[model samples]
Target: MTDASGRIALLRATIVVVAAGGLRALTYRAVAAEAGVSHGLVRHHFGTRDQLVAEAMEFAIDESLRGSNMLEQGLTASEFAAGIESLADRESALQSFQYELLLESRRRPELTPLAERHYGAYREAIERQLGRLGVADPALVDLIWFALDGLVFTQLVAPADPAPALARIRSLVESAAA
Candidate 1:
């Protein structure tokens, strides 16, 4: 396969690994079986279980940012807020998987650096967008992040309709920017 194909295959495998949540703790054999790829292929690309987990997490965050690229495209404040709300709604599974990875990262400090890197990338993206809109309130961003984290937690546990909560959050963000 070409390099692009290999990268795509690895990313697809990472998606499966993220979705499998606790199965990653079992074995690469299990993940390969679930991803419908050979165990050798999984090992060849990742080298070790810790590397695989970290790459899986990074892939997830990249996929999510790609899914929510409106901010990069120069959306208005309200539009960015709405886009984020919609992205959260659409990427709820990815967010839940991230929380699972967070739990794993606690036990596997090797993964923490990668996790922190992905999170910092996300925060930087948000900060860049806010700066473009002349919204320099770090406290507001922190509050939004706190609220977003709480919403993700609640959604993972109870699986509510996110629209109402998201609209409220968007309104709050918009108000802050006003």
Candidate 2:
């Protein structure tokens, strides 16, 4: 793999490693084994473990955004969180990786800013979609983000059908718009 692709691969491997075993399991050797490369390759790309975590978190955020409709403009209530279950199911590890980062930030002061920034980006995307639905209330937007966040987390821990809960959220948004 080229430098860019190799770096991306390592980042993905990092996500998988952290997702499965949390921050304690994030070692260069583990990531290298996951990516089928040498530990030196992981070290060469990210000089420190902190750098690896930060970069991997960024890559995970990009993946989450690409898989979500939160950033899309002009989406209807019915379209909100459509296929969210499948997306969550398919990207379970990716979602878990982000959650791990969120939890780790509480323990590591340095990671707090990065976690907040990345999480704010998701909240903002959801806010934009809410705006398109004619619900511009900041509190309501925050509530929606929380609900979506909760749903995603619940699904991660114990797989459940999210359709009904999402339907309720959609109805609430539609009523708020009305």
Candidate 3:
């Protein structure tokens, strides 16, 4: 593999390890083993476990957002809701990994800023989506985003079918515009 491909592969492996094991259990050797590369490769790429964990966390957030279509434009309500379900289905450990990092931040103050910044992306995306739907009130974005978040969180723990709740949210947004 080329340098870029190799780097991507390594990063992907790091994300899997971090997602499966959490930051507390992460080690360079473990990442390397998971990636099928040498431990020195992981060390050379990331320099330290802290750096690896940080990058992995960022990667997870970005991947989750991308997979969920949170950054896409002109999404219908069904599309948006389907995106949420797809994320939960495809990236099963993603939410758990995110929550793990969030809780870990309490003990590792240095991680707090990273966690906040990562979540800010989600909020910004929700705000943009609301804006696209012609919802003028900023507070509405918060309420809708939190409600959607609650739906996603509950789905993660209970594994429910999301179509009904999603349709209701869609109706709510439509009614708000009407």
Best-fitting candidate, scored by TM-score: 2
**2 or 3: which has the higher TM-score?**
2
Off by over 4 Å in 2: 81-87
| Per-residue lDDT of 92 in model 1 | 65
lDDT of 2 by residue, 68-148 (tens): 876666777767745333346769888899999999899899999778877797888877877887778899888877887
Residue 39 displacement in candidate 2 (angstroms): 1.1
In terms of lDDT, the poorest run of 10 residues in model 1 is: 17-26
Ranking by TM-score: 2, 3, 1
Ranking by lDDT: 2, 3, 1
- Candidate 2 clashing pairs, residues 3+ apart or interchain: none
Candidate 3: segments with Cα more than 4 A from true spot: 76-86
lDDT of 1 at 170: 83
Model 1: per-residue Cα lDDT over 115-136, one tens digit each: 6876676777777777777889
Q: After superposition, how far is residue 78 of candidate 3 from its true place, in Å?
A: 5.9
Worst ten in a row by lDDT for model 2: 81-90
| Global lDDT of each candidate | 0.70, 0.84, 0.74
